[model samples]
Target: MNNLPVQWMAEQSQRGRHLCLILDSTAVPGIHQALLHQLTHEHYRSVYRETAVAALSVGGPFIFSIDSLNPSSLNELLEGQTRDWGWLASIENHSIAILVKHWRERLLIGKRPQQALYRFHDNRVLARALAHLPESAYPEYLGPVISACFWQGEQWATVDNPASGEYPVPDAAQWLATPAPVNQERAILLVNVGQYLLAEHSEDLARLPEALSPRAWLIAQLDLAQRWGWQTPEQLHFLVVERLRETHTPGIKNWEPRPEEHAQAHFERLRGERFPEVKTWR
Candidate 1:
């Protein structure tokens, strides 16, 4: 919360922009229901309402008035959020419908025949996009957004909305027909998978082998794990512990054809056979 500066909020309030908390329904369990219980100061609107992803309205990003979040309620929401709490950004005079349209427009990528949707609510994607996108792209990326302050790495980073407008300023559709000249597909994948690990396998992440940094270890295992049908975080954790070692280089066994058992069961079977240096290797 400290990273969300009080002065910035005050300034935005003085300028008549509504302070909003952008929380993803997919990130917080029962978020839509929770909003029902905490609407004293304001309400919530799903970004999927009028967009191409409308079918996923129940599981998309929501923009809610900041007044709705309080100590106990916020803590409850954070319990489900894990490492990443959704951040704060202010909108100008735009209505919720307009803002939702703006966000929904962003979810569209690829060409006419090959449309794909990435999680715009993903903070890592937001951080990477806002940071790496070109200057002209800012207006395209953040239409009617006056200010955005969100966590970036170990500290806070703020994006200046140079094209803040009172009216709906962008037809993101215009830019979405073709891909961005700069493709961030790889960045999106890494951010999303890293986010998944942070959410579901923090213990494994903390115990990562010193021989490889967390990101490097993730890169090393990502493809193999996917190929081996190890998609769950628990399965990924098994890979992390088994393949990534603390003191020595990874000595992961290259098993042919994934076994038809749980990751732990597979590891236990290997271990029962007096697997070489399981402990010493990791």
Candidate 2:
């Protein structure tokens, strides 16, 4: 594969608000150098480290790193910190799925797409999405709305024709009042399976319960490592799950509930009523 300029990645962040930088220990040292350079140029402050061990020392509104990520390290690193920070998996392409799974769990947070963003390697698609947002949400949204995968190319193609009914903005009021639209319908649920849940059982890596199965739950435990510029990992995961749910499952109606609307909480209650098993997993 052709090596793309890491400087370009940094420059992309310069044009936006807060930047989430992911540096692979496997990458050329210049990549790290470039990151420092760009961060300085933009006068951006960050939380940073060279290893996941070091990453534990930092806090949010910052950037950090790990020497390499593995299941054990991921479990440990994820458990160490509670302050939300961006995540980067610097492993090879073949292992992307493992990282994706870890990243996948981040979808189970608040009810806004504006909460998080994820990028496999580059921010082309994510940046485009941010550009479409209203100005009021910027800067404040910088950290949560952006994410980066350590290896995406600049020439990344837009996911043209994202499946229809992928992101539906439901009326806020209806979402708060009705539980049926969520429980009665086959909507995908999001669960925060991160430190809050896993910390309870560090010795056991429990498979997320299928409590919401038949219906799906977006899990955000390991996935929120990187807070997209304005979006959170949870929001990004929701988009991905929404697409997958729309494609793989047929005959299921979709619903979007805002946090202010308390749609997710109502649904959580409904989930308990219908699938009491949810209580066990969560």
Candidate 3:
């Protein structure tokens, strides 16, 4: 059994993201059944609903659901036929984003988790996962606010304050709102890069340079387009990559050795360390 997709979905769920894939019943006959068999054999808790949908939980904080859309539901919600695989992936990605947004909102409002597994020490992991999703995957209504909350963190709530200019809250929000095209492969790269950025362990940190190289290349592309006044579909991708890269490592163009040290130190600090007080805030 090729476990790549299942493993990928599991990793995403661990980061508090859920994925739901809807496949055409006629075109992909028995595919869902085979997946169900694999998921069950692997001991993932599977629940089948009456509506031809199945939810799988891998004993994780989040649930990944796969829905084989019935003719009526597919016709009503997705306009009858799935034209592009990227579009289908985008729909599932948007659903995950919405779920993360609601979950984070609940955490911020002091809502205690009813289950032990649901409480995460760092809610930013979940936010980062949502932020890493391609801007194309976000729904028109929930994308902007959610991206603002995720990337800018506390600064998003302070948008009205003049001091909030230090953070790119407005830029992130605008970037999310803009429509763009993103393929599944590029989205996967973004997710991997996000994981490297948020990773707390040394081994994970070691992979940062390679993980972010694609992002650096993308940034260069966007920079060129903007400088030449060339219209491009990759603007949102550029903004997201640049914003995240800068937030983690400032004043560094492209991925290089110097920024790796800064990024490692930043992650180490975030991992909770003690250093002598250097200055007074007054």
lDDT of each structure?
0.60, 0.31, 0.32
Against the true structure, what is each candidate's TM-score?
Answer: 0.55, 0.25, 0.19
Clashing pairs in 1: none
Consecutive 10-residue window with the lowest summed lDDT within model 2: 157-166
lDDT tens readout by residue for model 3, 32-89: 3444554433222222121111121221132224333232332322231322211122
Measured by TM-score, the strongest candidate is 1
Clash count list over all predictions: 0, 32, 0
Off by over 4 Å in 2: 1-20, 23-132, 143-196, 203-282
Predicted candidate 2 versus true structure: per-residue lDDT over 60-148, tens digit per residue: 11332332212242332223332122233222223323332332332222444323222212233233433454444332223232333
Error of 3 at 81 (Å): 9.9
lDDT value for model 1: 0.60
> Model 3: clashing residue pairs?
none
What is the full ranking by lDDT, best candidate first? 1, 3, 2
